[model samples]
Target: MSAQHAAPAAQPLRPARAPTGSGAIGFVGPVLAVLTIALGLVLVRDALAVAGVISGDGWVVTVLDAMNGQTRTGWALAGGIVAALLGLWLIVVALRRRRRKALWLRKAAGVGIRPRDVARLARVAADDVDGVLDAKVTAGRRNVNVDVRTTGDPYTRDRVREVVTARLAALAKPPKVSVRARPSSSTSGGMT
Candidate 1:
């Protein structure tokens, strides 16, 4: 008389897209938008003044009059050059690619690890190596650099590199690891 119940099927996971930095577009896009709006407003105001909808001459007329009243050819030329350079800079920024802000964790859905955390992890791994007295680590999108102060001979940079690399193996794309091992100041007779 008893009926068996079937278990519900597990849902499949979707892969996450890697994140990218905002690049130059982040600042330039909003700045250009604001500048466009300001220019449009100025033009509208000038049109309204021409139609007698406003009392005084608009900003464009005032600027043109000031420019004409002053013998400022040098100033005008400098301004033009600056504007041209800015336009070229904007074009370059628009074409440049955004740098990555975080690395993806292996086999984890929608999870990311920042470079600071990666460096901390690498430092921990390096500290675990035999004879390592202290470790400093810096991680970028594509590289991890480790500086290790050691108890003295017997500890090598290769050992630190190997340990750090192994610890970071869980990252989706583990950065290239580099290690520099130095003897402790007390043992090496120099300040580290």
Candidate 2:
């Protein structure tokens, strides 16, 4: 007698696409800083001009003098104070944002988790359950994937997979669990 087997199914391939430009608003902060600096300079110039510190030859000087002596100094001081405040505020905001970005980058790089740390986490996860003869685990991005080899009993294998997944998930992020079992010489339990 001859036996025929069907060919395996083909899987669809997913293509990678380039990232979108939606995050372009990140440039607005620097643009705003430049505008703030320019406005500050204009305010300082007008203030100095009204106080007779600069030559009153321009239209800005004429407008300042037209508002009366008292109003002119008030306007100049107000403008100077607003400009100074804006400039200082912008600098403080930029520095704070820079520090936050640096902190986020350091955390993403796993802070102080070296190769030895990973190996230790994997070893601890492997030694969790009964029939778990051997296990291997690796972490990526924010998730962990573990592979387990079990002795014989189906219940023990399932229990090991569940316990390891739970323990690793608690310590790390959510983990994906995969179990491969070798058939025993005698069938003591059924596979679920």
Candidate 3:
């Protein structure tokens, strides 16, 4: 009887999109809202000045006068209304960002894990295996690498590899595991 092997499935090309850093939108959202509001203020100011309520100064001065000017009241009322609306929009954007950042901070506070945790877990697991005399594990942001000093026995090295792989899987994200069986004298050789 012939054994049949299944072909591997093709992987997706694009990485899945994860949520951006918390409060990222908060930083951007307010700036955008302010710009939009400024634009609205400009348009309204121009309209009012054309109608002869205020002098056709730049948008900023025109809008300012429209709000505070008493006698010359052409588009003053409309400009004030538009400015108020823009202010409200800016406030809303700021508030939304603050809320999102608060929520993200709360969540991150509870789920924090450090790279040291990865190294500790790997060392413990490798040391517990039968053939491994000692183990050193280093962890990076998203991965870990381990070095195992063995007692010159293939079985012990294999056991160390297996245990380390299993423990890392349980405690940390799956790390790339490499197993090296070194001569005892190599330990005296300065690690380069």
lDDT of 1 by residue, 1-192 (tens): 334666668988887667888998999988888989999998999999988998998889988887786775887899999999998998799779898788998878778888999999999999899889899998997999998898875546778888899999999899999887778766466433
State the weakest 10-residue window (summed lDDT) of model 1. 183-192
Compose the digit string of candidate 3's lDDT tens values, residues 21-110. 445455767678788898998888877877798776667665577768457565867898998997687666555633211111122323
TM-score of each: 0.79, 0.31, 0.37
- Overlapping backbone residue pairs in candidate 2 total 0
lDDT values for all models: 0.86, 0.55, 0.63
- Prediction 2 global C-alpha lDDT: 0.55
Clashes of 1: 0
Error of 1 at 92 (Å): 3.6
Supply the TM-score for candidate 1.
0.79
Per-prediction tally of clashes:
0, 0, 2
What ranges in model 3 sit over 4 Å off? Answer: 1-112, 185-192
Candidate 2 lDDT by residue in tens digits, 1-192: 334566668975553232233232356576787887987888788788768887865456666667665644677799999999976876665555331111112223332343334434655766577766766666543444556556765676567567656654433234355555543434655433
**Stretches of candidate 2 exceeding 4 Å from the true structure:** 1-119, 183-192
Model 3, residue 174: C-alpha shift (Å): 1.7
Supply candidate 1's per-residue lDDT for 130: 88
